[model samples]
Target chain A: MSTTGTAWTPERRARAALTFICEPGRPDLSRFVAEQGAPDVVEALLASSGTAAWSRRARCLDLDALIARAEALGARLVVPGDDEWPAPLAELDRIEPVGGMCGAPLALWVAGRRRLDEILRPGYGALAIVGARACTRYGQALATDLASRLAGQFPVISGGAYGIDIAAHRGALAAGAPTVAVMAGGLDEWYPKGNTRVFEQILDEWAVVSELPPGMRPTRPGFLARNRLIAALSAGVLVVEAAMRSGAVNTAHWAGALGRIVMAVPGPVTSGMSETPHRLIRDHEAELVAGPADVRALLCAPGEQLEGPWMTPTRPLDGLDPRLLAVREALPGRGSLTVDQLASRARCTSAACDGALVELELLGLVEQDESGRWRLRRPR
Target chain B: MSTTGTAWTPERRARAALTFICEPGRPDLSRFVAEQGAPDVVEALLASSGTAAWSRRARCLDLDALIARAEALGARLVVPGDDEWPAPLAELDRIEPVGGMCGAPLALWVAGRRRLDEILRPGYGALAIVGARACTRYGQALATDLASRLAGQFPVISGGAYGIDIAAHRGALAAGAPTVAVMAGGLDEWYPKGNTRVFEQILDEWAVVSELPPGMRPTRPGFLARNRLIAALSAGVLVVEAAMRSGAVNTAHWAGALGRIVMAVPGPVTSGMSETPHRLIRDHEAELVAGPADVRALLCAPGEQLEGPWMTPTRPLDGLDPRLLAVREALPGRGSLTVDQLASRARCTSAACDGALVELELLGLVEQDESGRWRLRRPR
Candidate 1:
């Protein structure tokens, strides 16, 4: 299984083993591995290390069994040199540490039909939508609607949790677009167990990835470390709803550290679930996004006009010349106005008003009756 | 009556008559009045001008009747040099015009018990809360609550309209604070008679102001002109809810142009009323505020610390050393750990972990069991 031609190499084997030994995003270990190469670092650690946590985890060797378990689950190990490895994840090593966590994953256990790198490539980026597990219905509906509208263009990414995360993934699925889940623990078992159905559907159409090897349960530090991956793997992160102390805010922190576009959806200030998002927006840590069009305006490539109608819905009288617009607004809602009366109300000279009236007439926005009094063509 | 103390001077009478002649916010007339004193400009228009709107209205002047009606309504005219005139209104002359309307009012008809200058003086500011007349319950509740909370510190200002305006004024009155209503028309009769009760209460306890004199009705242009006064009188303007084309957005624009702090309260994205607030926040035209505390932070004098408990609620272990925080987070919720075990999970050296545990013990955050394992002092 560790042979050539689609099989794991020595470097891949060492990286896979490292995931089981050292915790994800350990700066010291990652730096050491980067300097000395993974296989050499693994060799040195396994040879002379005593009671150190990495050595202890390494002494009990079950590399073959771990690989077999992953294979049984139809999961594959993707290391740094793999063609399917995401390019954006490389940014994690360059960004400053966040919450005592940093560094890209040594290896990822990927379980899915879709290619991880394709959907997340530059110019065609991914959006991560995250929020509270006990979000309000407003949050849930907004998350779903925003994801559904944007996922067709930008693949949605999120943790496969109960509330906002699952809603985002479901929204993407509803749009017939593949979504990605970056998990904190092993790919063999879904963490919550309640989301097994959604997890299964994701595996059928998209991808679920973890930095931890098979048989490892999630830890508090693991979730924080996993957030860095979520931030690094996407072009932008949109926080829908979150409490002050939540994984979603931590994810936004990571996204900010990685220089990813951080956006937040505004909800009722009365809702506790919206506290973090509102705080982020108020503090200038995140851009306030109202809907999918706003999300696209920030995430889409420059010169790309992908915004939806909600961005700036044109009223019937939009785009009119200022003089014409003023003349139209000056016209009475229920009664007709003579040219002089309209000119005075609009603060325009008679010549300017006459010019505006002719243009307004050409646009079919206003009409003059036989008595020469002007009113709206379609009065409200 | 026109010659004694608190009586109208030639300049004051000229300004009073001009209010009934030219429309409010007419740049040309306001500039003419500013360049040539009001008394001289009024004489010129009333003497020789013909067929021009100002001259036409000037020729039909019933100055005594207008003055008598204002006196009957208990409304007094305040002009530029008056002691009670707001200094902020002077900025209107320098700002670029909006909607073809600009310039300070020739005179303001103020009806209230409270002195406008005292409440709106520098270092002690007023807040303008405006929104759509057809607002949601969420908007209504937020407007009322925000106004109530902020009005005590800063007098609330708003339009005397049906929905958010009336709600905001009522909130201020409920808090036993004065609120000012900047109306589009005469202060003699409330535009929306449905709000007559609230308007009467305001006139009794606070103020109802307008650039238009008594007997003048509000027109489409008059409302646009009125929004400028709401912006000019406040230190900050907070848009609670508004459609894209509503007066609240226009007030926010005036606030920006006047170099005043512009703020907006966020609500549900599904609401049309929240659209303008969200758009303003998204475009960086306004800051997103959750409630009163945020409004105060932006509006309060420099170096003032008026933030509330909701600003940043401190948790029990918030100020702990990073090593101790990391160690605390690493400990399992249901179990205890040895120093070495904790160090490994916390990604800290064993010596560092031992130091952190000692400090954690001193803070009563963690303790050692009989078997010498560390656990939380108040375990969840």
Candidate 2:
């Protein structure tokens, strides 16, 4: 097999066959593949000389049929040394194992429009947005808003579940940005038939990826194994809302164990859906985030200038009403002004100016003094 | 002037007279009283040798009439050296000044049935519950629950206003515990007449206190000054809910400045009332508390056993349903059991056992395994 170009090598076929034989996040198989190369490990497994578990599983595998099935589904296999493979997945080998799960996939089956390397670049990384499948309206709204605002700068990644995940993907797509959906099942069949519309939309513009080959079904272990890939692929993870012992909390734990920044949006303490987020924030395991700015502040470098949502300076002043703009401009450069004095300078009635001052204060443009005088707050 | 006995000494009369003369939390007068004693400071103010502001206000003071008015209003003055004076007030002299306000009150004009010293003992301390005057129903409910649970072991102190304060005092009174209402105005006249019913109930069983003498109205500065007394008098402060710029945030700042444990309850992000609590928790100014247990966990010292509310071990298991108890008892000692296995062991249907497991999981009595099995969580 050639080292470069579009031709398929023997080693590539062996890696593709291994994805169907062993489950994802198998540390022993991953380590074996790393040390002995894919073709050698595949030959050893075919010999049936490995452990009882591996030998028993290998006896039923057919390598050529799996490769043909992947091709029939229009899925391309990307191995570790492929040009389109993400480099951050290598960090999985260093993290402590969780729930008898560890290590990166030896091969990934990609079946979508966008290239993985182009979307998940080296300097600019993707953000994983995960939450409860049975979410409240508040959680859905916040997830949509955060995803829409962040999509322009970063690729929104999620597990493509029903509530929060579909909302996030729809938000990013609404903003005309590409979003990747990592599926637990094969690309041929979406695990949740209810989310077929969102899955189709994601395949049109971005990618739907999985470690399992075509014709394989999603299992309990498959979903848990997929969470590590979501955490390892993203620069940071933002949990919109989750229950006490849900899958989202499991993903957050993986994010933390991988040394990635973990953030959670706070919700009403009265809701059962907010329990995990509240526990994460209350126990100091995750930073509290309200919007895209808070997410960027935690994910980006200190001096990196964020560009979307409220970060743009021109938008805040331009969005103000005429009366509010007049009131903001009427304040003195150094001293403060009372209601009557501001009314005279702004060329409006005192009541109108007072109402405008309250709006301005909410926008953080002005502040009230102890003597009930109004002054322009210094620019941050 | 006699130094002892039940008879009112001349110095005691001078301290009583000072309560009517100076405003509460007046650093200048507090320092003067501390250095020169109450009688000497009263003499200097009467001779018009003090600052222009004090001399101008002192000229209108009639000490005898003021004392008679307090007596008619059923109020008595308690000074620093009195046995009924709260010792925590002495910490006021050491806290950093806020809003140009500092120092303990020269004397407290108290009216009601309970003794301040006995209610606010040296070992046990009071918890100040303060929030917005215009609060939501959610805030009121949480305030009531926390106060009712905490009132058994600690005195619930608050600024007896219309919303959260009144709710807290009413909760404590409903639990038959002595509560203290620290008023911004004189104890004789409650500031918000809407809360007269609650104020009356508090007076029948607890104490209403203020630094200003009877017949004095509450001013903006007077309200700000009274916040210091609320902070200094409490062992800890719990902010139920507040707007962006409210007095509750100011009280929390004072609590932090006074080295008191500052805590806030989180609410829905959609509501503007949760802004201050969210900001406090986000900025690390206050610990986030959900209910009374979270509050006690922060306020109680290490190894100090908390006795009220959910802290009592006898309450939890006794409150569980029979089905949940049977399911909990069916779990194995070492390994986890599937729902079907638990159902067979507990002699119940699978669906019933499933429901019981969910309820037990919520109560934190049981945990689910990765393979969909149930196990008892180790006791906290």
Candidate 3:
């Protein structure tokens, strides 16, 4: 499938896949579908050889009613290659999926004005805040503070499970940034049911969405499915609270496989909830983040945001080279410029300006990170 | 000058170095101290060249106490290369005590039953469990569980601070294994004071120890000093719970420099308590541990606990080949058979039996984590 855009449509591929997985031995069929691609996934289900595996792919669920329900909720279906699709998730196809960790979304049904891809900026990458269903006050408070502090930077993504997940979504909402919730079951049912009011409120402002088929019920497996999406869609997945054998770790592993940043909050070594994140980090699968600043800096990463030509400084007009002086004077409001752009404006080729930009960067003549497209270095 | 395990007794020398650190244009004293050997470090402090630095070191109350109180506690000041020292802790000597990040101990006033050297068994290593002072339930629980489980196989080390520290010590004690509590302050005031019961108990049953001297109240800097000891004395350091810039991670970095395994217990990504561990693990500076089995399997590192010898039963049976067969036949319940003692009775030469033992090990017939000179391998 050419992934530039337009590959996904309302084909019930998600429902088809769900139907297939719900059957006996069809879980293994995911491998075949992944290798063969989506259309082939349906073909495999239809194949006589695969009939024994799923046996129920032909059973038609009322897909239209489900679509109508989501529509009534004002949700939109986000498929692969769509303009709003999360590009980082492309790693899902390249990163060798381990176990059932492969993340190929049938579609991410969304219900908000916020675009999934836009939130995943170079510096302010999306933060996935997930944890135990039974999080403590320590976990809740920390989650709230982190989400609040990071509100202006990274929007939070989480399951609407109680405890840490709810805390994260609440934290982000409080920060006035949209938080997205990926549900385990159909967005219609609101699996926990208790969080229905919160879900409606969230739907009103941000997004409450899922990959599960419209009528599909939440199961242990569906939770697993939901987790992979949460991890895959973000630039980094941060597990707030996970027990020794938590499902949250499965998400972390998916993020690791996708090469997305996997971060885990550490807890008392005594708590069962702290185990999974510790394991992910200790195994060198994730990065530790202290707060918004660390996450913000890392999200910028190496070579992401450049401040100057980062090659050499342009000499001043005081006995300095004329080319350097020209470029330096052209800076608007003391704004910085890169070598190539500066070269064009200074009436010189990039070769000459590159050398000048480096000196400026080192001399603290410019600042970087907020904009890779350089800026005048402001002193602290 | 020699590491008579009493190097810190030359108190004037340590004072002088502290003085130098407190002087002008000496922000990088840790690097300088690290370059100098223990005796050289002590001497540099005592010489006239260090007078400017000495006055600064002399002003600190804890600095004054380290010389006198460290001795009073029956704590022989242990430094790197001392015969009575732990090999794992050799890394501490490499760090200069600047900004409390990489400094090796000026001296470790150890007071306990287990000598540092004896516990430094090649295979059975050490681990440090550290975390936030105002830790969460999740954080505390994880720290305790990790410590208790690891205690059976390796010594658990910690800062002996509040929250997570208290939990780790209690866990180890509950497991009936002695733990090393590396304190920031002198033994007199257990800083938090709430932990006085356990602190005093440790001095009796285990050991409440530090690099600082007796009566030296824990300064923010001294607490940082205590972190290095926790890092160095262990084969690895496990950060249980910490905010992004929390002190526990400093120990992790120290352990990283020491080339020790750094592990972290993960919590809810939402919880700030988990920030440090997540950061360390995410950055690949620490390993993630899910449970006791995970830590034990990693730290104890059970190698090929499979059954079966590589070769056939025996090729070179010597004279007692048939007798060795008889001994095998005579076995009812599993038991240990001393090399010569079993050989003499079986009428086989000790040399022949020794070869068989090596072969047995290779074949996976028996395994040994307890390295021994003539150790008996339990039957597979």
Candidate 4:
């Protein structure tokens, strides 16, 4: 039985066989498939002598047996033309290989009750929340909160690793929102073993996606290849906490290369985990995101404002009365000035200045020091 | 007795009277001083009718008495032409007024053991480290460490307030380096009585300077006016920690307006004190600085690097061995790949890949996962 349509076409079955034969992100194979089509490329590889890596790898593959194993594990092979395939993955075809890895997967072994296209639709995109597996408590908390807040508006996508990733998925699940786990291994095996429960929960409600066929163990290259998928699939990638050299930073680089927004949450400079975020922000590689509102503001369309429940209404200073606005402007951006000093600068009488200060104080627009000086209140 | 030269000139005496009569940074008086010269402007103001603010204020001044009082308080008057006057203050004369305050002080009433000119010279320019008076313990510690680290190369300049300022001065003093306190009020009366001991220590070892004459109290405007002096006196301004509306941010603005390097140390975002630093860094108004090395790197002329004591030598990745570099380039920026996976990507035999991995691991260029996969080590 075909999972994508009424029946699997020759091209679709060939693409499925190619996934088992060639490793994910083989640029040579992808170029061949793009130029000659999957069925032609598969036939050429299978019939060739042991001259190329693909031919040697394909010689041992039992295509029918591999397809049967995927079906038995309740996985569906979704190729590029499938209705369940995410459209954003097509962007990967244009990216030059990074670390000898490039191009869209030949076929995705997807296991979930939900459809991938519906979860990652046009307006409702996915946000990849990723960070160090050994992240600090602060990093974990920020990742969780950010994911939970954005989950309703967008699917929270992440690798199913410990620390930040687990926290993000759990946060989305706790909010009863769909979250996707883009794994480095096959759909049948949970790589970390420690996160088996989280993987099970994601499988129950969301999707666990892989490029490899059933029972194939995760390789280091597979994880790096997997990062590109996470970057391509999401509208933006938010690095909550990472060391100076981390996989999260790698993901951010991929996001940037793909022209996606790369944002990072800042932490104390003293923590080793905060180094990547600080460096990214300092080098202008990533924008600094304080909370969910900042993330929403960056990702959403200009006129489409989505205020999270946790965000406070930001009252614009321009809405204040002209006199009050003048008074506020006269106050030093830092430090205090007395009413008389403020009056002279604000071009008003002492009485008028005093009245404005009182009104401003009542509105929490200004504050008075112990020495009876006035200054603008800092907006939260 | 004169501190700067053989004897104080009549022009110097005129400037001293101007400081007592006109408030610091009055653009009208500053313009008058700039156009007519300090002595001529002082004469004109004292002789004129009560129309303009400067003339009205000047009419009541006892110029001789004010000079006598300053001398009696062991304070020497330093005019623009005096050797003791810091050259950087000239930038103030060119700055367009901010909040009705601008221009160089007519004269500074200085009281200290160390000479002002010697402490704030061209090659050994001062660094202004300012922050919140109500700062956190973390802020205080950072202020102290940064001050102490830079003290050997640069004199520390700050307002002698209760929190960050006092800590900065104490840190510099502990390092046995000269520190300058640019106070708002006269040197005779320490503004904040609580910081009297620190002020005494500073006066005994360094310098306590003010635009206001002896016995005059600090007005709210005087403090605001003093901030510009702090900004103008330094080569750069490093905001350690500040609230949203802090004097440190005001100082940073002045530094920016005067084309000085403005730097800020990042702290935990959860703290209210970090708001100003984060805002400055986030807005690109200030460069992010974690320690003295960053400060040195920014302030030093291009190719005139001064390595800080705490800085570590950074090795360039391009300097690695050829085969090792090839293996490194083959590794994904994030995640791992097994020996076989790596060999295929590196275009080398499995045995060659294993040898390179061992060499790379020894060099701390790469690390192995629990599954014996290899990945590049993130550089600090």
Fnat of each prediction, in sequence: 0.97, 0.58, 0.68, 0.45
iRMSD computed for candidate 2:
1.2
TM-score of each: 0.80, 0.80, 0.54, 0.78
Ten-residue segment with the worst summed lDDT in candidate 3 chain A?
Answer: A306-315
lDDT of 1 by residue, B1-380 (tens): 11113687788888899999988887666667878998888788888757888888988999889988988888899888778889888888889998888998888999887668755655567889999899899888888988877776678999989889989999888877768999898877679988989988987787788999999999989999999999999889999999988888889988998998999999888888889999999999999999876887898665464322112222555334566789989988877999999999999999999999998888788999999999988946
Which has the greatest lDDT? 1
**In model 1, what are the clashing residue pairs, if there are any?**
none
The C-alpha stretches of model 3 lying farther than 4 A from their native spots are A1-103, A106-125, A303-380, B1-380
lDDT by candidate, in order shown: 0.84, 0.82, 0.62, 0.82
Q: Give lDDT tens digits, candidate 2, residues B272-294.
A: 88888888888889888877777
* Per-residue accuracy of model 3 over B146-217 as CA lDDT, tens digit each: 777566567777877788988998888877766778777665667788887776666665555666555556
lDDT of 4 at B46: 79
Structure candidate 2, residue pairs in collision: none
Using lDDT as the yardstick, the better of models 2 and 3 is: 2
Query: Per-candidate DockQ versus the true complex?
Result: 0.65, 0.45, 0.32, 0.34
Query: Which TM-score values does chain B get in all models?
Result: 0.78, 0.79, 0.66, 0.77
**Tens-digit per-residue lDDT, A110-188, candidate 1:** 8887767656655677899999999988899888888877876678999998889999999888777768998989987
